[model samples]
Target: MLKNKNLIMIFREIKVGELVDFVNTVFYKNANIVPITPQRAISQANNPYAQPNDVALVLALNNKEEIIGFIGILPGKTMLTDERFFWNTCWWIDPEKGKIAAMPLFYSMLKITKSNLIFFDLTPHTASIVAKMGFMTNSITGTKVFLRFNLNQILPKKYAFLAILKPILKFFDSCLNTMFAKKSAKKELNYQVIKCFDASMEVFLSKFKPTMLTPFDNTFFTWISNYSWLTTQPNEFETAIAKKYYFSYITQSFVVELLKITHQNEFIGIVVVTCRDSEMKIPYCFFDDNATEKVLEAIFNYAYNKKITTITTFHPKIKEQLKLKKNTVLFTKQLVKHVGYPKQFETLGITNKLFQDGEGDAVFT
Candidate 1:
């Protein structure tokens, strides 16, 4: 336990009861925090990353024993090196306590784990603070690119004039699409996109060579599927070839669409897109170089047909190729940082590995 004159900090694994209480008291009450059901809380408590008898949650309270802030940690292991790391997630501090309150909670997490901490999906403000805290920012950050499918819908009401320009934009966009379209046309191919996972999907994923910062394997995929609230649910009547996908519109603000891409009756890839409001973000895409363009074309067509305003991705290769197409915009660059020994990272030689959006809990959101 660490304490200041006005603040009290405790370092311990969160229990199931406390987890439920926090969800009801803090998450349910706050619009910012995503509410978790009792079952989901139990799943989090028993997650592979959690220490026995404790979910990796750190809490801060005032003299009245009221919860003021918390930091959730998800345990992870490097596939190549098997190095254990705690992924920092859902960090928050009550605005009333001021920014300084975050320091104690962060320091407490470090003290408790005494291991490497990986921070992904950091905003500019949080990135600056973590950099000052002795965390090394990865030189290879994630790239993001956006393609506006429905220009008129994306334009704000105040910029209604932009609606008139939509036709011009679409004309230019079509020209660019034609210029970048694949030259070689094969036989009229049939592509199947479904929401489900089966043994066949697992077999396809096995062939995936993880070139990202995070090592993803069967264990990681299985762990991710357990969060029904955060991820797409399996369809009850799904066949061996197709799995059903479900999302809670009321509770889950975001929807993860897992599309198993197949061509000519063969598994080509899997594309996972998270949709929120008018924007759709591609967090994970597993396909070969040959299928990259095809998969992307399928996604773009789907988005357009669905009237999705924007489609975005953090994959460098995808972003690079999309930039060549008309109306594709480079939105922003995300910085990834870690609180670990420099020598360890150097030894791993994965500092420059490619990072995707769905690499961590970023997919869940």
Candidate 2:
């Protein structure tokens, strides 16, 4: 730890092996702020791509020894180039308390990684901040198709006072859904949702290696599924940590599953889906290009039966398919997500890279 001006102390590169101890000792239990939740810390410690000396996090603490700024780094490997990269998982700075520490925290990370970092889901403020840091920004188009009216959950997010009107909103939503109900001819499709991947799934993924940008294999998927960052069940310690943590730590319902899709007794594809609350996102989907219609039909049927509010995806092919099936959903909206990578990667053909919807830390939550 090094102390600087304004009496702030910086922990430059907290290694993966030390994450558990730092989260347990110097975090919420000892200070007023929590840098990382216990579950996330565990996931970081066991990250398959992380090495013992890899910098897992950078932290800034105030005079009171409370963490005021932090930037999490998850190590990654570029499958095609065989190069290592760091994904900026979460970057937060206390608005009222740590305004001055933001630059320090970010600078610390840049120094440690030498600008070999990639980040996504940038807010307007974060976008501007990163753009000024010599990082190149790119955009990917996604779609959020709503299959159900979710005003009860959506309204309160922007207007907190509407939280008390949940019962009325829920009633309105139910009435709208009933009005939009449909009965259509059934299609023949088979799928199995499993919590973990088996050897058969690994064999399925091996054939698509050339298309993947990240080094995603059975070990990587197993690490992700077994150690999800968001938990539906929170213990006392976790509950307390959630109150202070800046990022997602707990949810009403969270599930990550592997879907083995089969059509007509033949294996079609495998998909990784994460449903948090009523929203579902397809993080990774691998299927025969010609079988797009059948795979999408399977996904639509699953969402309809589960009463999922919306389905989101950034896959270009999937987005195009969703456009053709507008009648299957209540509504659809186009979304653009921003990604940041070091300007240095540009010389190495970064622009032509193919990124998955769940690349970096986008899927873990």
Candidate 3:
């Protein structure tokens, strides 16, 4: 532990013994906050990039040794290029200490990690701060598409236009659905959607070429499925909440759907989707160039069948295709940024790489 005036900073890997208390105090103590359980902590700590006994956290403590702030670290590896990187997630600092206190912790992370560091899904305000802190933002922007629009449900009560426009939006959405159905019908594609992550998925992903996105190889996918914190079993409290609220409650476990496309017993494409509530996000989609439209149509068909109100993607081609449709709504534009060593992406030969919405902790709502 290093002392700075009245405050002390502790840099250490997370330990199994302190995992429970650490998770509760850092993520769950507030009544409004949902706490991470010991199981989730253990899984998150099992990062492939983590050194032995590394907890991937920077804890700020007062003179009394009570935690005042913390920043989470997630280690990841690129599949095709075999490049390793660290993603910074879940940053929080005590309001009483002021934002200035966060600088030391941020600097600590940069000093410690040998691999490149990335920050995903940054708000404009946070992006501005990170830019000033020496992190460079990527030129690539994320894409989102809404398949359904609920004016009154999404808008605040103060907006009278929501109530007035709800019926109109509903009618328009109905017509849009009909148009989508027509488009899907025109494309006679044969594919089967499965909810399993297995060797077959490994085989399919092996054929995929990741340009700018994180590689989804067997090892990475296995890590995501077997060791990701989002895969843990929900505790009793979470189970009760899920039982009571069902569709309304935040999901405790990650939900993934793999669409395996085949025609005449030959593999043609694969689409992997992650879902949170009414939104479905495509993290990986690889198909023959000729099959893009058909694969997209199949994805929409699945989303409509599952009652998903929104379908989003980060692939530039998919975004362009979705934009061509009259009914698709733009949800939000996402920005990704990076810092630390290995700053030159051109040297790494991943200048054209594409990032997806489901990368890092984004898949976990």
> Per-residue lDDT tens digits of candidate 1, residues 88-142?
7657776775255588777777766564776776666777777777776553344
Please report, in order, the local distance difference test score of every candidate based on alpha carbons: 0.57, 0.81, 0.59
Scored against the true structure, residue 282 in model 1 reaches a CA lDDT of 81
- Candidate that beats the other on lDDT, 2 or 3, i.e. the better one: 2
Candidate 3 residue-wise lDDT at 306: 67
Compute the lDDT of residue 26 as modeled in candidate 3. 30
For model 3, residues 1-365, the per-residue Cα lDDT tens digits are 66667656554445434565665563344323232434456666565555544446666665555456666667766643555577776666767752555776777766655536677766666667677766666544555666665343456346766777877767776676565533323245466766565676667666556563576654455455554444235677655434432122334335666788776677777777777656688877777677676677777777766667667776676766776664544254443333222446546665556566666766544
Which regions in candidate 2 have their CA more than 4 angstroms from the true location?
1-8, 182-187, 195-200, 347-349
Task: Flag regions of model 1 displaced more than 4 Å.
Answer: 1-18, 21-43, 46-54, 98-100, 139-191, 194-200, 210-212, 215-253, 263-266, 327-343
Give the candidate order by descending TM-score: 2, 3, 1
